[model samples]
Target: MNHQTRLQALSAFLKAQRAKILPDSVGFTSGNRRRTPGLRREEVAQLAGVSPTWYTWLEQGRDIRVSTSVLDCIATALQLTIDERKYLYALAQESGSGATLLKEQLPEISPSLKRILHELRFCPTIITDRRYYIVGWNEAASHVFLDFEQIPSEQRNMIRLLFTRKELQRLAVNWEHFTKGFLAIFRAYYGQYVEDEWYERFLDEMKAVHPDFNILWQQSDVQSAPEVLIEFRHSKAGKMLFHLTSLQVQGSTDLRCSIYTPVPDSSTEYKLKQLIERK
Candidate 1:
């Protein structure tokens, strides 16, 4: 979709989702009879910590210079999952262009490569496309993502999960920093497959969620892999920061091998060891 249409869609989507939440669902008692459908505009405004006038303007697609923190609050109010939230940011990126292609399209993952990842199962690993789609994962990687298996087959982008799912937020040791980097990576990876329909659809979804994503996407920040330290707030294992290591697959530039490295002599390692032993 074009930028203006996408922004309007985002505004409408937020309004629709906000209207669906009964005050009781978000913890406000409603004793009066129905006026307009769903919770009053004021209710959502209060819950999201935004002014009612500002919320209305945002819904109306007028003068919304929203910050990530405010958008985060709105996500919480709207009960968006992490994937949805990331999609929201993607749509709200700063770029003005239509979806651009980063990587050339390729056929499906080869059996030989799949076998290799399986063999490397001891390492926490996942094979992702340029869009950060969770194309394939081994046992160790799968174990870290217990909830991932439950996601609808197509909705498997890591950044999306980081925003929409509360469990994802729980898993984030430093969510804000992690998420910003994730967007930067997407921008870097854009040259690979930005023209793909799936990538555009991903952008559209974000536009429906957060305007900030639209702004960021327009800025076109290159998303090459960086020296990343990620904080994983694991459910059973608790929290730790791991350095991320990424390698592009030989034949397919879009496919990547990313490993998580534990810090030396850190409590995180001890935690991982104990967690592994228990399993």
Candidate 2:
């Protein structure tokens, strides 16, 4: 996006976020009548330790340079989540140069990588792009999860399926927590690609179909891909736990391999073995 557009987006985002905060929540007295829903611009300036005039100018999208420290103060005053804070920095152009660049065209998965995914007979593995599109998976993954082959290629997004696919939802033990992690991770990626049309369209479609998606997205929470333990309930395998590990592809910018390793000291390993063997 152009400088002008970015400034406008920043302005709108600030106003929307401000509208969500209540006076009582921030320890302010809501005496009688209030014109606006959230803290006023002057109140935000006071909390952020800036002149009201300057803050107003910033909100108006005036051509101004915002320092990192000032941005942090504003973020704190707004009670922005980590992902939201990063997004604020990005919109203000106070973040790193890399945040401004568009993602490179996704490269095709190499034969070697496909072989690696296929060779993992025990571990259920799947590959996803930066946007959580399920680009590839192994048979074991199909067995543990749903059959990706049955789903249309265009609709193979992991996030989309997580919300829309009933079978996948049944597999996850804690559906709310499971979906939130994916949403948070997706939100972080959205911050980087705010200018991308695909992200905008995907979000709009998801929000339209699922009310929960709209609500969770408004929270603006963010999380990096960390090692996490996930429990799954399969019809044949029963209760199984897996250590989910995500690895970045060595040569590709977008490709990430997510492997579900059976957690040790549990029946998960034996169950997975039997399940895979029967399949």
Candidate 3:
């Protein structure tokens, strides 16, 4: 969508959200003979701590600059959910930075990176780009999760697999937590390519394939990649815990390598070893 169209949509969205919230919802006494269904623009502005005129201008879709903080306040005042907040930002496109589309062809993985994946005997490692496309992975990763090679190239997205693949649901002990974190990280990256055709296509496909994905994607939660503890239910190894770490691939701005290592003092290490031996 173009800038004007986006702003218009955002204006409409805010107005709709505001109309959904009744006066009593924000602790106001409901006086008799209310004409409007929800809180007024002035009331929203008061609750959001912004000027009524400014709020009105925003709702009018005027070309006024808005800060992230003000938008956040509005989101809070409106009691927007995580997904709603995200959708708001997606419409606003606050940063003014342009989105760079991915190349038509996938970038080739460096030979050294491939070797590193191969050499990481104990760690389950996978390489992905900013869009979460699985470009490379080690045998350990294939064993820990499903074999990426077996998945069709177009369908080898981590986020897509998490939601659509039944095996992933069975493997992840805390599926909701994992998916939320993944979505947050994905959102963090999404801002950089919000206008890219490929990104838009992927989002459309995801929404079409998984209804829940659309709900989560709207939450507008953005988080940097972080080290996290995750639990997996391995058919052969039983329950296993890993310290999942994401690191940027050196010399590559967009590529990232993720490694899952057994947590210290856990039987996960032994279990992984056993699983490897069975292979």
Q: How high is the lDDT of residue 29 in model 3?
A: 70
Task: For model 2, give the 10-residue run with minimal summed lDDT.
Answer: 94-103
Model 3 error, position 221 (Å): 2.0
lDDT of candidate 2 over 1-279, digit per residue (tens) = 456666776887788778888988888877677888888898889899999999999998888989999999999999997767888887787342333223344346889989998888778999888778787899889989889999976678898898888888899899787788777777667656656556666777988998888887766455556578999988888998999887878773567788999888989878877877785
Per-residue CA lDDT of model 3 for 68-117, tens digit only, reads 89989999999887756776676665542344635455567988888999
List candidate 1 segments past 4 Å from native.
1-107, 119-122, 211-220, 276-279
lDDT of each: 0.65, 0.80, 0.79
Task: Output the number of the lDDT-best candidate.
Answer: 2
How would the candidate models be sorted by TM-score, starting from the highest?
2, 3, 1
TM-score of each: 0.55, 0.75, 0.73
TM-score of 2: 0.75
TM-score of 3: 0.73
The C-alpha stretches of model 3 lying farther than 4 A from their native spots are: 1-49, 56-63, 67-99, 102-104, 250-253
